[model samples]
Target: MRKIKAQLFISLDGVVEAPDQWHFPYFNDEMGAAVDATLGQADTLLLGRRTYDSFAGAWPGREAAGGEDAPFAKVLGDARKIVVSNRRLDFTWRNSEQADGGPAEAAAALRAEPDTGAPVWISGSVSVVRHLLAAGLLDELNLLVHPIAVRKGMRLFEEADASVPLELLSCETFRTGVLNLFYAPAAGPGAGTYEDAKTHLPQH
Candidate 1:
C-alpha cells in the first residue's frame, strides 16, 4: 500500500496557518532543496478543499508564466490531486478528483489501490490531516517547525481529534533555525516508555 506523508509548516506554538507571512524569513536554499526533494518523491497530492482551491488557483498561473518557479509549478500542476470536501468541487485543474466523504475512508481507499511505492503527499491541509491521523491512515509526518511563534493562528492539533502517538523518524536543523521533524505513527501498543514506572522500580 502507498503511504501518506503529511507535511506542514508550523510555528513554535504549533500554529499552522498563513505561513507565507512568516515562513520566508527562515527559508533558505537548504530548506528549498528539502521541499523540492519531497515534491519529487510524491506522484499524488492529497489536499483539503481550501488548500486544493488555493493551489489550483495559483500554481497553474505560475506554470504558465515560465519563471523560476515554473518547474515546481509544472510539477504540482501535473501531479494527481485528491481533494476531500463536502462541497461540490468542479475542479478545472488537470488530474484532479474529489472525495465527498470522510478523510480516512477516502484516503484508505486511495492507498489500497495497488502499490505505487511513491507516497501520497499532503501539505497545508490540517483538518484532513487530523482526521487521517485519528484514523491511523497517515504513515509519516514532516513538520518544519519555525522558531517564531505567531501565538494566535489556527493550530495544527487544536483538539480536532484524539491524541495519536508518533515515533520520531528523523530530525534536522536547517541553517536558518528551522527544525525539520519527521515522524511516523507508533506501531503496536504500550508505546510509552515511562508507563507504570513505579511498578518497574525497586520495591524498597
Candidate 2:
C-alpha cells in the first residue's frame, strides 16, 4: 500500500489558491530547504489538472538551472506523475500519465497498487486533496502557513463535501514566521467530520 500526503502553501486566513500572487516574498533558503526535504521523501506525485499544468510549465527547465532547487526539479521531472482530469491533456513532460476516473475511486485504486517505499505526494491540488480526504486516502497533511492574510482567494477547505477531523502530528516555526503544520486524520476521541474542524478556522 502507498501513503498519500499533501502539502499546501496557505495564508493565515486559509487561502490556498494562486499562491504565486502573494507567496514569493516569504520564501527563503530555509523554506526552500524544508520543501526540498519534503520532496525527497516522495517518488510519486498525484496531481489535479491545474497543478499538473502549472508544474509541467515550470519545472522542466529548472532541472537544468543548477541552483538550490535544481535537485527538486530533477526529482519532479523524473517521478511518475498521475494527473486526475476529466478531459484529456497532452503530456509534453516526461513520466506523466492521465487518470480520468472519479477522483476518490481512482485515488483509492492507486493507493492499493504497489510502489517504491517513497510516499505519493500531492501539492497545491485543492480539489484532489479534498477528494482524498473525503475518501480517507490521505495519510498526512502538511500546511506551510504564511503570516499574511490575502483577504481574498480560494480557500483550502471551502467546498469539501464533509468536514474531516485531523490530529496534529507536528508544528514548526521558521525564521520567516512561516508555520509548518503537519497532521493526520483524527483517530481517537474528538475524531469527527470536517464540519467538526470548521469551528477551529478563522472567519472570513
Candidate 3:
C-alpha cells in the first residue's frame, strides 16, 4: 500500500488555523528551502473541503501566472490532487479530482491506485486527518509546531473515543522556534510516548 503522509503547521497551543498569521513571519530562507525539499518527495496531495477550497482558489491562479516560481506553486500545479468534499461541484484544476464521500472512502480509493512509489500528502485537513486516524489509514504525520500560541483557533487534534498511540520517529527545532516532528502509529500496545512528552526534543 502507498504511504499517507500528513503535514501541518500548528501553534504551541495546538491551533492549526491560518498559520499565515503567526507562523509565516518566521519562515526564513532555510525553512523555505526545507519545505521545498519536503514537497519534492510527494506527488499526490489530499485535502479536506475547506482546505481544498482555500488552495484551489489560490494556487490555480498563482500557478497560471507563474507567480512566486516557488516550489509550492510549481508542485501544486503539477501533482495529482484528491479533494474530499461532499459539496456538489466539479474540480477545475488539471490532474485534480473531487472525492464525493468521506475520508475513509477517499483513503480506500487512494490505496486502490496503482503503486506509484510516491507518497500522498494530506495538508490542512484536520477533519480528514481525524477520520483517517480513526480508520487507521494514516501512515505518517509530519507536524511543524510553531512557538506562538493562539488564544482561540482551530485545533490540530480534538477529543476522540480513545487515544490513538503514535511513536515519535524524529523531531527538530529550527532557529525560528518552529519544531518539526515526525510520527507513526505505535507497533503495539503501550509502545509509544505521549505527544507532550516529546515536545521539547530536537528533531532527528
Candidate 4:
C-alpha cells in the first residue's frame, strides 16, 4: 500500500498555522536541502482546500519567477496534486484533481492505486488530517516543531475519541529552534484506533 505521509510545521503548543515569522525565516541552505531531500521521496501531493488554494496561488507564481530551470520550482510544477474540498473548484495546474469528500474516502481512493511505489504527502489542513487520523489512513508523520509558543491559535492535536500509538522513526534539531520529528503508527491491528462515528466539532 502507498504510504500517506503528513509533513507539517507546528508550534510548541501544537499550533500549525502561518509559521512564516517563526519558521520560514530560518529556511537556510541546510533547510532547503532537507526539504528537497524529503520531497524527492514523494511523487504525489495531497492537500486540503485551504492549503490547495494557498499553494495553487503561490507556487505557480514562484514557478514563473524562477523559470523552468529551478529545482524546487520544477518539482512544484510537475508534481501531481489531489485536493480534497467540499466547495467547487477548477484546477488549472497540470496533473491536479479536486475531489469533494472527507479524507478517508480520498485516501482510500489514493491507496487503491495499482502501483504503490510513489508516496502520498499531506501538506496542511488540520481538518483533513484529523479525518485521516481518525480513519487510520495516515502512515507516516514528519513534523517540524518550532520552539516558539503561540498563546492562541489553531492546535495540531485536539481531543480525539481515543489515543493512537506512534513509533518514533527519527528526530533532528536545527539551529533555528525547529525540531524535525518523524513518527509512524505502532504496528498492530488496532494501533491507530479512534471513534468511527460521524460527529462535528466547532472550528477554532
Give the best candidate by lDDT: 1
- Model 1 C-alpha lDDT per residue in residues 1-204, reported as the tens digit of each score: 878888999999999999988999998998898898787566899999999988998999999999999999988988999999987879899999997587988888888878787888999999998888888899889999999989988998877335677899999999988999999999556544665666788877
Assess each prediction's global lDDT (C-alpha) against the native.
0.88, 0.86, 0.81, 0.78
Q: How many residue pairs collide in each prediction?
A: 0, 5, 3, 0
Name the better of 1 and 2 by TM-score: 1
Ten contiguous residues minimizing lDDT sum, candidate 3: 187-196
Between candidates 2 and 4, the one scoring higher on TM-score is: 2
Query: Which should have the higher TM-score, number 1 or number 4?
Result: 1
Candidate 3 regions with alpha-carbon error over 4 angstroms = 187-204
Model 3 lDDT per residue over 1-204, tens place = 777879888888999988878887878876776577566566888888788888888877876786575446768878888888877667777888887588889898887778788878888889899889878899988888888888688897786567878999998888998888998977556555678669878889
Per-residue CA lDDT of model 4 for 1-204, tens digit only, reads 677888888888888877665677767666666677666556788889898888777877777787643657568668888888887789887778886476899999888787657688888777888888778899888888878787677788887667767899999888886788998878544423234322444447
**Whose TM-score is higher: candidate 2's or candidate 3's?**
2
| TM-scores for every predicted model | 0.90, 0.87, 0.86, 0.83
Residue 112, model 1, lDDT: 88
Candidate 3's C-alpha lDDT? 0.81
Ten residues in sequence with the least summed lDDT for candidate 4:
191-200
By TM-score, rank the candidates, best first.
Answer: 1, 2, 3, 4
